[model samples]
Target chain A: MEFTLEDISDDEISRRRDLYEPLTASVRELVDAVIRTEVDDDSVREAHRLVQAAVETLRAEQIDGSYGVRFSADLQGMPWGNAVIGLRNAIAPPVQTVRDSDGRVTADFTLGAAYEGPSDCVHGGICAMVLDHVLGDAGSADDVPCYTGTISLRFLRPTPLGSLHAEAVIVERDGRKKIVQGSLSDAQGQTVTAEGVFIVPKNWDGPMPRKARRPGEA
Target chain B: MEFTLEDISDDEISRRRDLYEPLTASVRELVDAVIRTEVDDDSVREAHRLVQAAVETLRAEQIDGSYGVRFSADLQGMPWGNAVIGLRNAIAPPVQTVRDSDGRVTADFTLGAAYEGPSDCVHGGICAMVLDHVLGDAGSADDVPCYTGTISLRFLRPTPLGSLHAEAVIVERDGRKKIVQGSLSDAQGQTVTAEGVFIVPKNWDGPMPRKARRPGEA
Candidate 1:
């Protein structure tokens, strides 16, 4: 379900991006409050009333369509609605990534109490989500579109809810298919490790070859 | 992490449950709008301001702690803040499940555009999350606590965004260890299949066994 970048001007992209980030931040605060608040029933009910009214007011003015994925020519291949990278997604952590010349991608972020699964630890599913996104993105960094075909993860230990790091690297390649290995770690040490198989769709015309290496030569 | 049901009365649980459901619904609606709204930049900014003000107002009337997991005595094992089942989590779909007398579990739910990953299909990580949760829950239905130790998943095809179904069954059990197999499908057919090893923590005192089973026993 790939979408081509729209022809929106850079100015519009900046405008929309600026407008959405603050809104997302505010909503994120609300999410934290919703999960952590210990107000009494009376206060909770009062807050709910005010929140509902605010939502209704906003709904009354909305246009009748979803904010479809948008990408500018300058920022090609970036989907503003991406669940992992999209700033507009409140569930997405403030993940930042750096890709080294060796084709490894490393990310740093924090998982708050909102993502808790086992008591004070991060949710196992969220760990899978982060690894899947980082590994898939790493595979596609070769300028070839690749989709995840299979992923297996081992949870070595419960990932704590705080600063975390993840790294993904392509371990092998076979024509349009790639195998990637990744790991997520916390302050204590490695918490989860993953391996995934990614494949480029048959119809995709990938970028012209930079080096004509054989399938097993890379 | 696990939490024992507090000694709260049924009336308090019912009171709090009734209050939270509508609030969650309102916030869910707001999430949909925040992702889809198409108003002009000025309007978007105005909405942001109002939303922020409302959040601040609620925040000012703060409670000291988080809304910890709570369950009534009648619903002893239920976790209200569960990532898969929590009504207060906007990111969670409305997943409903039924456990039969034989201990098999089946679930039905819809994945909206919010969960999209590759193109228009549901996110691969989201698929893993749902399977982990459903399978883990299925393994725990025998009045024994089980946690997901490892999960392996194969994506047969892209899972489209719409109604989906999942089922899980315990294939084998040995002492406190269990092997569970699960599948997720859409209208077209099976899209993903999974196998997981669930472990009851070492200190757990599981229910008195009807029969002692070996690793290969059904």
Candidate 2:
């Protein structure tokens, strides 16, 4: 089916983006709380029960399905429970992704002690996940809607727990494919790099706002 | 430094590949039992305890480190504990990997009920991990120790859980960088396709035979 972002209606997407934005900070705090809470076991048990009850309340409002991609009329897209981009998910490492008008995407995140894997170092797999999400999104400019085909990581240096920066840029493009690379670094700028190909499905229905005005086009 | 697969003493890395070969069939039986056992809870509980005991006994006799990489004096190499190549690891599916002298790598694995994630399909992450390991090995061929820098995958179809085949080849290479593409298929053919970049450390050692050589040989 011929698809374009304009068909969805721009205000719808923007309203949804605006709807989730405030939850960004709230979700970040929730993740930190989940990770670092040092309350006694009984308190933990009580908290778990309360959380489970809250979840059931929300579950009452949902359908039987997995989280899938969703878009807005103006093409302001959002992935509700996105492992990385979902603004309301506490399990996510709490990343704020921004893509510039020039099509470069960057994310800034501060990982805490909760993200630790190897005693003092952050888990390598988690690092790979972050890179995968950031670079995949950056490569797509959040338009192509790419999935992580493969992610490889080199631990040049141990990632210390604390604030870290992750960034991605489209290095080049192949027909229907995007070459994107990304990195994770400390406050000092010591960096570990990753590069991958982001592909739009041979068949995808996504945004296209720049075509010559179609008949009756806005 | 210069290195070759022959650098490591035979006794240091050699183990009869059969040590874990039988476990493949045994694990399959265990999985079948899990699926078919019509026993009461007490019987199931007993079975679970027995399985745990067997696992602990095996774990006690093993090494403490994550399986990194190993090569033999005959120039035959293997990273045996790798979730994909690890013969004895029940957690790893029954996959065998072989790299030809010319540097191409092929992986063959059989998925069973235990590997399923969505009712009847192989877990998406497991498929990606297997492909990552295969592509990582291909890029690291010629002894260049490239860590997975980035991998992106496209899931074309639900990889049916059963006997599967994957082949990977280096599609592009530059100084210290290799791009590889490979695919997964059942008896019929291609199901999911993957491509990734394996990157060599900037200044450590060089490619394969050379990386296998001992330090200071240069």
Candidate 3:
């Protein structure tokens, strides 16, 4: 009883979000070929019987529940199935953000070997889930939707494994709380640094629908 | 170049971990039927052209490499491809732990809607990635592996979704650091509480291979 993105229709949510972003980028390239496949166990049992006959032809055409969150008046609050920025979530790296007219919320992404950890870095809980989701969207960059409550991280090094960057800023608020500040960089710079509070949910009375705010917010 | 579980062989890692846990639970039920299929936009463009012809028949039966970490001399330092408790990670919930000879470690799982957030709860960065993987496996429960350098969560409520529970212990230690206290419960109790520090890696000289400890430690 909870699905929203205002329950479908803005050209059928942009034609099913352009048909599930190339099928979640071909299941994120079959999750980086099942995390770096090296073949043979008879070619992984013939690619596991051809991915089990494409999972039984998509489970013989079915659907009863759960693909919840869908919102779109064209990508606002970006819920294409958000696990962390769902572009149809192939376990999201679906992070693509930009919010600036001085509000500042930036993010760029890349992390493979399915978000690794330690011997090739990048997984300190996926850099605290991308700095707790870009510091809860930079504490709602003032359009007010917030929610994290608390977050604190400080990895400082070891975030490697391909192009990454994140930024967030808000610094303080209170009375329904805010306090943001975030980071996560690679290619040598900051690795992880976050601080969050976020709140705004005494049953959300107003403020969130500047077309849902999150795609170059203002 | 860095794929451990001591380079495979406990009966071929228990027959490829019992053949990829029923093929990652049938691709996690075809990822909950590609997120609740309500078919028809011509059966979702014929189930997205039969999932792009099953992703071009497993990209034409090829294999280059990436299923990296795999360790099984009986799960020592358990890295079956961990995202957070990897059982071949269909986005991990391979969480099944027990460690308590007074070292304490505990965990139980459940949070599907593929780990949602803000609306059926569960997903404050997956309760800070299951309290940073159970407070970095309870600061190495004494066998010393530790890693996460900082963690701090609070949340205090809103975790609901289904059967959770987590725990961690080791309330203090220093010298190679430790701290660790964790939580995340359901059925209306403690919905997130953490404190961590962890460390132990200034080039990991010795300590971790006590069969990768942390499952009722000794």
Candidate 4:
């Protein structure tokens, strides 16, 4: 629940890279199954009853009320649930963030039936969410954290499901603001385009951004 | 189900407006209740079930499946969803598209509990979707259809729920490619900002974009 720089050593980062990265992938699949499972109604009732028992067991083992962040020597971060950076989360898809040298940002992921809104195509709301986060990543940079001052999107085409990649970069910056550019591409690399702006607080100081807030900063 | 300059007489627009004005007010109340109600779960379920039945009854009386579009003699156009000009949609948010005299494009709306993502903030994706649509309107120019060729966004801060205003204007244009800038604002103004390249498709010749395709067209 606390941290010293000693906790984020490069060696710890290396260890999580080895251990947690694969954990994230398998857990993501488990999440997918929970949503798509075709178990009978009676079976669902039984499962929930059983899960309730496990929940009680976990409650008995608690030192804290929340799932606190956990870290190894590698500084690999794992914030589970619907967290943008989760460790062992299943509901989350194959999405992972990547940083480019110019502060551009991208996420690569596969979307499935769980994301459907139309009979086909990814749900418009889901597409917007992915774009918002990826573009937010580009605008935040590693230095000055940016919040969404304003954002806009246009659904020019139907975005099909399955593997997709999104990319964004800073098109312009004015003082505390950034104009980020990006797109979602299917595996074939046909892009579904997007662009947005990000701004920091008028002053440099505020509650720290997500990466800075580390209850997991062991 | 079709309307043209010749088929629409002044009396029809006036008559239709009289019928819909109060439904608009009632729908607003329903949305407000969805947000503020603190009824017990059983009551909530009962109310929702009753509302669904009432809506189904009302839906059956309507002869047509689509809402229509119209322009008053004053050229005050109400696209009414099916229009290239869109207004309140139950499936979509109550996004009201407004065009100013200077050709700037904007939308004014309030987002509530249904849009929440973070504990207290609006969902990042919803912010991005509104911004993208607002920016697209600028590129569309109220005439030439623009598609979401690409959009980029940057989130500077968490957008709190309740009232939000977003605007977009053309930044530049070259042939079929147009660049527009946009932002989302609160009472304090300007929460998330964005820009996009909304395009005039190179190969298509149509009144609206490929999607929103009219029932008979395909």
State the displacement of the C-alpha of residue A42, model 3, in Å, after optimal TM-score superposition.
Answer: 12
Tens digits of lDDT, candidate 1, B1-218: 54545677757766767877776666666666666666666666776776676566556655444334554455433344555566565555646666766878888888765676656678788888888877876787676767788889999998888889998889999877899999999988899999999999898865623221110110
lDDT of 1 at B36: 61
lDDT winner between 1 and 3, please give it. 1
Reference-based lDDT, residue B133, model 4: 58
Assess candidate 2 and give its TM-score to the true structure: 0.49
Interface RMSD of each: 2.5, 14.7, 10.0, 14.5
Model 1 DockQ class: acceptable
Query: What shift in Å separates residue B194 of candidate 4 from its native position after superposition?
Result: 0.6
Q: List the residue pairs that clash in candidate 1.
A: A1-B119, A36-B66, A67-B36, A118-B1, A119-B1
- Looking at chain B only, the TM-scores across the models are 0.85, 0.76, 0.38, 0.73
RMSD of 3: 16.7
Return the TM-score for candidate 4, rounded to 2 decimals: 0.49
Computed on alpha carbons, the lDDT of every model, listed in order, comes to 0.70, 0.53, 0.68, 0.53
Which ten residues in a row are the worst by lDDT in model 2 chain B?
A: B209-218
In candidate 4, what are the lDDT values of residues A107-213, reduced to their tens digit? 77876644543333565546777777677767766567666665556565677767788888888988887887778778666445666667776767765544553
Give a tens-digit lDDT track for model 4, residues B93-206.
556666776778777777654454454466677676577556766776645665666676666667877778889898888888888888888998777778787777677566
Model 4 Cα shift for residue A119 (angstroms): 15
Error of 4 at B119 (Å): 3.2
Q: Between candidates 1 and 3, which one is better according to DockQ? A: 1
Off by over 4 Å in 1: A61-68, A208-218, B61-68, B73-78, B208-218
Reference-based lDDT, residue B21, model 2: 40
Off by over 4 Å in 3: A1-9, A14-47, A50-78, A85-87, A90-131, A134-138, A144-209, A214-218, B1-9, B21-81, B85-87, B92-142, B145-176, B179-196, B199-209, B214-218
